[model samples]
Target: MSAPTISYENHRFPPQVIAHAVWLYFRFPLSLRLVEEMLLERGIVVSYETIRRWGRKFGAAYAKQLRRKRPSREDIWHLDEVVVSIGGRNHWLWRAVDKDGDVLDEIVQVRRDTKAAKRLLIRLLKKQGLAPKRIVTDKLRSYGAAKRDVMPAVEHRSHKGLNNRAENSLCRCENENE
Candidate 1:
């Protein structure tokens, strides 16, 4: 029996530089080719394809690591839904956030009914391992029913201007997607 050989090539620039180059590409609206040109100016010439690969590999890894390190604490969770278009079909983005504006969970669903709202809440609670003490939501009747079904003990607030935090978070996500 024979074993396959593994080889590693050391990069000319440090890992941090390569990681930063990829991070800047996604953190802004610039195209990959534009990022390549910017890196060229810094005396580190690399192709756009290479940068794309690095970003896909490292960006997701970094995000996952950062999420794992975050603390899970019980707090007020603001919940909201926004209309979105996916593949020419209307969808809704259900989002939950903490009082300090940290995202707890986000899910895309085909409807905004009670069942959908319940599913979103269950997913968020399961993933975060904590039920919100206070849930702030818009005046969506579905939210009232969902809260009653899934978390009857949790306080629910549904005032017109009170859910601005979650609404603003949805707007930020929408703007970034655009």
Candidate 2:
């Protein structure tokens, strides 16, 4: 499929410069002024306000293009669950990621049991439209039980070390809950 094109009509800067600014702003954890400084360092003069405008105008097109790519059936999914505290209560955040560490899906639920695991697996299957070649997770018995019910044919690997990809995909804020 062809990639979606972003229009840069009536802009003072070239398409490359504008695209770079927007990319820098979204691709990193940088503030708008930081992005402005980054552009200036590259000999491109642009205001942070202009950069913000370009992001607001063109960011959706970039995001849409990214969301168009689908997970492959050959992908090995790494699944992990973390406990997070919200409003003085504990919640489970189930997350799945491919070998490349791209998040496939995530859900926040009250329980971290077999039912929750099944829900995450079902969501992943429906969204990806295919079962992964294999699934890896920590030594969580819920994963094993859920996999048997949701996708009994796929290979399941349960090991703490093997699930680092999914573990790293979790945000630092969730880690702080421990």
Candidate with best TM-score: 2
Error of 1 at 151 (Å): 1.2
In the range 93-168, model 2's lDDT, one tens digit per residue, is 8999889878889899999999999999999999999999999999999999999999999999999899988988
Per-candidate local distance difference test: 0.83, 0.91
| TM-score computed on alpha carbons, candidate 1 | 0.63
- Which pairs of residues have clashing backbones in candidate 1? none
Tens digits of per-residue lDDT for model 1, 12-87: 6578677778678877899999999998998888999888877876777655544543434458889999888899
At residue 1, give the lDDT of candidate 1.
58
Itemize residue pairs with steric clashes in candidate 2: none
Runs of candidate 1 exceeding 4 Å displacement: 1-73
For candidate 2, the C-alpha RMSD (Å) to the true structure equals 6.6
lDDT of 2 at 13: 98
Which regions of candidate 2 fall more than 4 Å away from where they truly are? 1-16, 20-68, 171-178
